[model samples]
Target: MRRVLLIQKAADKKDAKPEEIKKSFRTMGVTACQQMQGKKASDVEFLVSSKVGSSELLGIFENSFHLTNYENSHKKQPSEEEQEKDKEEEALDKDDRTKRINKKVDNFVVSTENTSVVEDQDYKFQQASARATEFARNLANARGSVATPEWMEHQIMDLLKKHEGKVGEVRVLQADELQKLGMNLFYNVGKGAISQPRCVIVHYEGNPEKKGEVEIALVGKGVTFDTGGLNLKPSGYMEDMYGDKGGSCAVLGALQ
Candidate 1:
């Protein structure tokens, strides 16, 4: 990294396009490797996992490679022959139509800002989606006793804590509490299991500036682990039965 820094500093690095920054880092890596090897580091010889897509690689490296090293035309002085060619090109650039078109093409500040906003939105979407999917998948693979109602409650609590003050209030009603309240559905379903039933109600007001309170609400049953109770599991039917709480997982992630 220090060697690459000594080679050339990438100016307006924060301004480089996603693709441009990626190629620059790859070049920087090869250059650093070549310096150590005392021989050319063939970029073509570079290997990557076949399972990962080019776009996926970019997404993985985006944060680390945020500061790019792009070449600046003004930093390096042009040779006499190159200067002469530039002079000819400058003379030919007197056409107003071409110059106007080129000026418009070069100015991309507004578009770039809009693009960054969209990219951030996309990144957030992917993050929340992954959270939901992972919760469901993990529950599916975990043992029936492991991914219990209490475990699911803890997961949702952790998620709320991670988001901090964004959420308003959270209430977890246990088996005895549900029975007292005359809410028998949740209690009955989870009663058969080792761990008692728990109903988690998360109250979140998404909008503050609006006239009224939260306009929308989501409710889901989080059946963390489901093994056939009295009727024992038969054959392939019992596999991944814990994933039945996908609805609840989706709700938890959507709170993001």
Candidate 2:
């Protein structure tokens, strides 16, 4: 099956109807617009699996898009109370949307009628990959203050353990362990500045028969939370700091 990832702006109004919101997506005339604001990546999988339906379209609206490589638009900073309230409201909206998205993904995964004989062999890999993406998102979406490096390490370990036999191996390099290896040299301003940094290494063979070939190596930075460290971010700019671990998220999703 083929897949596509579309990133679009979130609706202007939170209460906008799905159909109206769908129309606002900048598809550039690709013709796949079914109107879904599901934030999780799995939603894309579902859309592609269904052949984009008879209408040949799907729409995904995203509200939070942060750009580190380019100039970002400036906005007036809201008060602390307003920031907290917005965060809470966003969380609630996310929870509701996730529940609906998962229902669709679960239904798609469990349905066996569409599977072909050849697809059976790849079932485990598919499931593991999807689970990895889900777990990574969980970590990324975790409450800001709670998603520390140590906490994220524990979560990754737990997720890997759940996929035991299917994956070749999983290992974690603890903060002290990394320091001993002089990995601190690679970190900014030395590792002493950041406390308890950890790394998770997942080994899952893409082709079992070619084991030990070691054809590719992937690296991802798992910064559980970025509080701007020494140079803190100004008021409103710091709200979405939890997404600093986005690189690791992509790695986790690609591993399976």
Candidate 3:
């Protein structure tokens, strides 16, 4: 990961070829070679890397290359008009590609929407009803409680089933593994609850052929409700803690 460069000057007494300069560098334990451009003159420049300190490299650079005031004459300057033309060309190319891809996507999306309308009616209606009922119940009885209802596990399972095909496996982490990973934070926070704390992982594969390629990961801290614990909060603050599960809901929504 570290890089060192040794610049050598051209021979003065005798004109040296590029190959000869390269061979000379190899003799000095330079294992890597990099080509460089001379700043002052049209002479060729080189960058060589060796397992040597900067001071040692500098000494080699000075001794190998002859010092000369050779000014570079091949500097290229682009005209304003040429630069503008290149920009216009690039923009046009980008716009054309965007239009083509968008057209294909629009057609496919329309077809998919039409197909779903006819085939997914029954399942969609059932989901809509379930969601409505869940929403109404949460809104009506929004209270902070330490006990986690058994029904929450069923809900989590349902969520996992809904996203099973999209995301590979949904598994709860064992207590020992959780402790080893120092995830006692969740256990500590949820200790007072009647239900024991659980950590769940939702694994997904974006590319099935490339098994290990993980394009995305989503982690949700699902603390159903908070009562401020030992450091008790004001009644108003505790009331709002009932919505601590909002982050969990958001992640489920996005995955769906």
lDDT by residue (1-256, candidate 1, tens digit) is: 1122234526437677877866664565445333423321112122323332334332323322211111111234667887686567658775332211111111111112223432565444433454455454444455666777878787788778776656776788986889999988767766887777888887776565662544677887676565327444577755656666767766775774
Query: Which residue pairs in candidate 3 have backbone atoms (N, alpha carbon, C) closer than 3 angstroms, thus clashing?
Result: 8-65, 9-65, 9-66, 40-70, 40-71, 40-72, 41-70, 41-71
Which ranges of candidate 2 are over 4 A from the true structure?
1-135, 166-170, 185-195, 226-229, 232-234
Predicted structure with the largest lDDT when compared to the true one: 1
**Model 3: per-residue Cα lDDT over 16-124, one tens digit each:** 6655644554344222211212111123333333332233333333322321111121235657886676577658665432221111111100012233332344434
Weakest 10 consecutive residues of candidate 2 by summed lDDT: 61-70
Candidate 1 regions with alpha-carbon error over 4 angstroms: 1-132, 139-141, 226-228, 232-235
**Prediction 2 global C-alpha lDDT:** 0.49
- Residue range 30-114, candidate 2, lDDT tens digits: 2222222233323333222342221211212111110100111223466788767757866877654343212222222222234
- Order the numbered candidates by lDDT, best leading: 1, 2, 3
Cα deviation in Å at residue 34, candidate 3? 69
Q: How does each model score on lDDT?
A: 0.52, 0.49, 0.45
TM-score attained by model 1: 0.48
Q: For each candidate, what TM-score against the reference?
A: 0.48, 0.48, 0.40
Give the better candidate number (2 or 3) by lDDT.
Answer: 2
